[model samples]
Target: MELKKRIKLAYNVLANKSVITKDDQIRSMLDFLGIDQAETKGAVSEATYYACMKVLSESVGKLPLHLQQYTEKGGVRKAREHPLYNVCNSRPNKYMNATNLWGSCEYNRNHYGDGYILIDGAGINTKLWLLPSKNVEVWYDDRKILGDIPDIYYLYSYGGGILKLGSEEVIHVKGFDSLDGITGMSVKERLKNTVNSGIKSQNLINRMYDSGFTAKAVLQYTGDLSDENARKFTKGIEDYATGKLKNDGIKNIIPIPIGATLQPLNIKLTDNQFVELRQYSALQIASAFGIKPYQIGDYTKSSYSSAEAQQLSFYVETLLYIIKQYEEELTYKLLSEKEVAEGYHFKFNISVILRADFATQVKTLSTAVNSFLLTPNEARSKLDLGSVEGGDRLLGNGASIPVGLTGIQYMQNKNPKKGELHNAKK
Candidate 1:
């Protein structure tokens, strides 16, 4: 297609055409990161962007990704030799480690409402790279897609020089976009107003500091005064406020003229209004980004238990959904049609976040072993200990049950000592 026809098709195909909105910051962000950079605007504040991205990236990066094959009982995990495993756990690309790959996917998803993980190579040997949604244009016939038998997919990826666009046949691991098409709703876009309010609040505070912390004050005179005299009086007051006193070059104390009285007009406005506005604005921004309010130091009406619950909620409600989306995307995009039919899939092991202390782990493993759910060797292996000679045998309540109906018989046969009696079955 020629540039003119392609441009027309692009507009016809894309839900949001190329055109930056009026807001400068939002327009720049969209042009930089939107699906169609030529014409779009995504609302996001400079104040809360880093905080939102940091929280999301760290939350996702710490999870362990695994490739598993289904079994009759459940699914058995595969690592080391698995081709998908190596790509996800060992190496993703030349520049990024496993954490970087996972975290960057999540970071872009949160910021752009969609993240594209491009998969390269074939079978087990694969490489993954993130494609900014702003630079990616998905081209497919709408009628073909509705029929559920689309023969071709044209994904245009723009990178390299200013006007260069790259085309590829293989599809990338597509992050879940809240919206249906290229134009998706992001957290940053959702909190545009709140973040803008925060920006305005910050500006107000900065203006306060920049004007020697006395920008809200006014000059008034009881008797008639000329405009020139009024200007002079104001200058005198400003000089006194920011003047040298006690040989110090600070603006704290000032000597007033004999009959002049300086009354602060916005004393009430400066006291708690802006502070509360900013505090509320910060909470809204954090909430919009799915971050715990306490994480950003909003302790209003917060208690120890509440904070703990919020932390767990962040993992369970927010991060778990994101992690599951990534797992499904990786499974569908990474595995072949034959592999998917064979029940191969990807999963994230989030147990690291819930990892208990050494004592707790040992106690839990011991209980599992005593209940005959796991052998001693299995528990030891979990603890990274080498196997011992009889560790594989399952031990009942009272030593090994070679030929016993009850644990008491074995206990009586052994005649356990007082300390050993603690292992007796109830």
Candidate 2:
């Protein structure tokens, strides 16, 4: 079946409130969409499922604006000539324009320099503004100061020449030079810092391993067994610990004695019992029964014989009891096989327009606006706006204006930053 048909069928089933497993639902959806079953026969990988969901979610949107903007050239021109342009150009009276006052006295009033003199065309003819009376020292914003001296000072764009004033003092100004070729102690210090970080990471891993608990002990405690079998399993463990089973590894020995009669042992549990079971580890359960967790596995395997079978049955019931107790802690629904199959079949109608196809669709609307039959806002509304794929709102068939553009208002809100959609979903 085609994927679309299969999805339709799945949607019908879901609408009827039928119970089905998650896997079944996915399978049905794929079948409806006409997706080949052979292409995805095994367990669904996380990546494939996520990709399919993403495509389905994004398939309803219109073509991006950049591609369609060319169709509305007249509207674009009108927007640039709009009265809002004059409002943006007007500047505040107090803030002086730096470009206009560069060589003027007004620049000295705004800047933190003493009287400035513009040297006109000496050797380079470049405008050299000087702060001679006061030695203008520049410090970085983050630089620390000790008394009147800054720890570090940066000189920017000093004229490359020497100037002598009267007979008393001379100032030497040199062009900026980079320290790229200069190697010093700072490089060595950086290398040491990197090595120290690696050592710290290794120490953290070692500490985690030291404090970790073993999985074997936990599993044993959680396993269920009859009283007699439990005792026998406990004894076997003790024997192994004491070197009694040194010659024969515990793997060769059956922890629960053979020929032990067993009966169904039902443990009634309340809501609180369920909650507490989730808190207990498998090791804790094994400790309670005085047996190893692996012994429970051995007991389960030995159930083929009539006597051992009885003990195994009791252990099986105990396992179910623990499971029931833990079920309360589950956060998601456990869909049945059928429900899952049907969920896979859920139908969603997705409208897709190729770049070329979308252009054609909006061409008529653009023509109408260019001819002045429609205003820019009116023409924009006629072009599908709500159909944007991957946007927050789902599009339904209607003539409603696109979000952020309604009535006579044409304010352009900033586009969301990259990765914002993914973050919003999370």
Candidate 3:
């Protein structure tokens, strides 16, 4: 009955936006219908799940997100002068840094299945704020109330009331398994069974320890006592097992009542393969998050070489999609139409995260320079080395020729004996 009331309240909040609603009304509405923010947090209390979230959030948080502009030479450079550049690159608002903004956004994305950034103002006075995904509801403007064209809008329940925001006002980072593109399926919802099992497994272990490592058993009594007495007796046993009945250190003896036989179950956690079950659950959850087992400190079958390969694979497979989504969303929502048309957008410097060992990096850069794929100065810039004289030009081995002249050298040689003789005679 209570659940139904809350559901009705939520519908009311969504349907009627004629007047402003208070915080209490919004709170109750979310309490029943919205994402269980508490439950989402509790799920992260599991070690494996928390680790995966941390890995993803921190991976994005550490990289520099810059506003970039296309150069005449068809290359990109940071657009330092743009008004919104500093907001995304460093301080999003007075209270948060870029790291906090990105990390919190990712954490919310994983926890709530959607993360939102509200673009508070326009132009020079712009302020970016992270909105709690639970409090924000997405609605499509099917009625064309806001504009003639139907589009998605946001209803944010905050202190004052439900604030209706246009699509441009919010940046919605969606998760996987979204039936409708506007909303995403949260990790907690998608992997509820596995996560719940893990939590239960942890609780079971805690209970076992609290009972002084005792297994469950049957207390077979010959006769039944009165209801009150039975209740008291059960309470006494539980108190004794949990060490709540404090007598002066009478260690290691649980006295059995007369005519009652305690039949031990002889079941052990080891017998049930509890450890293996936990490991399997961790791996399964991690895999769902696109995390390699080795990343979460499970290097059971890892080699140094394989670890290196997995690191590259992690960037290509996992982080690439995550970064690209962020870049596209940020570019679309933050930049003006004119700026986007002028080829100005946002990009994350992912090279910082994918940096290889010094020796490998040097070798790779050297090969790029040798093949004329990168100018000597360009390769030097990657190493943070100062440019040397004449290093700006593309330099390669003498034997290598341009793609257009691939067979021209051979053709010249074949017709070349006559040409060579003419040159010699001259």
- Best candidate according to TM-score: 3
List candidate 3 stretches off by more than 4 Å.
1-41, 146-149, 220-227, 230-234, 257-260, 301-304, 375-377, 385-426
| Least accurate 10 contiguous residues by lDDT in model 1 | 160-169
TM-score of each: 0.69, 0.13, 0.80
In model 3, the worst 10-residue window by lDDT is 17-26
Candidate 2's error at 255, in angstroms?
A: 23
Name the top lDDT candidate. 3
Clashes of each: 4, 44, 0
lDDT of 3 by residue, 1-426 (tens): 377787877766777744434444556566666545543346888889999999999988998998999998997778999988899989999999999999999888988889999998888888899998877888899999867779898998876777888898998898876898889887878889999889888778777778877677777777979989887887766666657665757546677889977787777778889899999999999998888888898989676574457768888988888889899999898887999999998999988866888998999999998887899888989889999999989888889855554555555466567666455445
**What ranking emerges by lDDT with the best candidate at the front?**
3, 1, 2
lDDT of 3: 0.82
Candidate 3 deviation (Cα RMSD): 5.8
lDDT of 1 by residue, 1-426 (tens): 345654554453354444322243354444344335321223343455567678888878887788888766773746446677878875788878889888887776777666666766776567887666565555554576523555435353343322222223233333344555433467666766676666666666676666666644665557878989888888777776644342555557766766667877555555767677777777777777767776776667676464345657778866777777677667766777888787688888776666666888899999999888888998998788999999989775865553333555644557776656555533
lDDT of 2 by residue, 201-293 (tens): 334445435523111231144456899987877666545434466466543343433544223233333533642442233233333322333
2 versus 3: better TM-score goes to: 3
Superposed by TM-score, candidate 2 places the C-alpha of residue 209 at a distance from the truth, in angstroms, of 36
